[model samples]
Target: MGEWSPDTELDGYEQLVFLLPEEPTYALEPENSLVATLVRHDAPRYPSALLYLHGWKDYFFQTHLADEIDGPGYDFYALDLAATAARCGLSSSPATSRT
Candidate 1:
């Protein structure tokens, strides 16, 4: 993990990627390896934080949900779990295939 960098998927935000060790996922995950993303505002304004996590075969792209929810004194963030492995060639298996 390193400094937050601009997220290619969405504007007005930054992201950090963590390369996790390979593990058994059965059908839901890829055996080649895994990755996770932590996305946050380039400059967080609130002390209170809110984190959103996307499910399998999904990545965080919606920013309005964060804008709307962060109004309640919360700094919004999102976690994308192994959602980009296949796209980036980190995993050889299909990211969306359950079987």
Candidate 2:
């Protein structure tokens, strides 16, 4: 795990990296492991929160979707699964059949 850092693609958003111990079949090398990226806003306007998970071949790059959710007084967060992140070059691996 790592501290939250400013998101490169989304303004006013932060990203946290969560390293998993499980073996990754999509990794380019053995040393490259699996990681899930948690994207979130710095502050929540309300107590409600929305957690989203992207499907295969997808990622958490929908800023407009987050904006729409946030406008309704909910904090929006997206979980970028390891394989998807890898497909986007956000991780060290490549896309795998497994979730």
Candidate 3:
């Protein structure tokens, strides 16, 4: 995964880009160099971590969920899939509506 940076699309969220390994089935995929973006709320109080993922072709961007999860002492992190992030002008991401 790449370095963490302030999210340009989602307020109160941090973003990180992961340069995935070259896909062998590149022809099946849209992009050659595939990448995944991780959006997170920087409030971790425990050793455990929680990884949140959204469904395919869906709209789910709940900032409050992160806060609620963080309240339970979990290091909250959510995946923005490549395509979703891209759609939101996150440069390279994928998701439905986050509004």
**Pick by TM-score: which candidate is best?**
2
Q: Candidate 2 residues 1-99, lDDT tens each?
A: 567877656778887776666745553545456677788987657888999988456656788888899887899998887766555556543222122
Q: Candidate 1, residue 60: CA error in Å?
A: 0.3
For every candidate, C-alpha RMSD to the true structure in Å = 5.8, 5.0, 4.9
lDDT of 3 by residue, 1-99 (tens): 457776655777777767545633234455634456677875346888888986355333687888888887788888756455434434332322232
| The 10-residue segment with the lowest total lDDT in model 1 | 90-99
The segments of candidate 2 whose C-alpha lies over 4 angstroms from its true place after superposition are: 26-28, 93-99
For 1-99, candidate 1 gives per-residue lDDT tens digits of 556778757788887766655544546554544656777877788878988876355567678888887778788888876644444443223322212
TM-score of each: 0.69, 0.74, 0.65
What C-alpha lDDT does candidate 3 achieve relative to the native structure? 0.59
TM-score of 1: 0.69
Candidate 1, residue 92: CA error in Å?
Answer: 9.3
Question: For each candidate, what is the lDDT?
Answer: 0.65, 0.69, 0.59
Task: Report the candidate with higher TM-score, 1 versus 2.
Answer: 2
**Candidate No. with top lDDT:** 2
Q: Of 1 and 3, which scores higher on TM-score?
A: 1
Clashes of each: 0, 0, 10
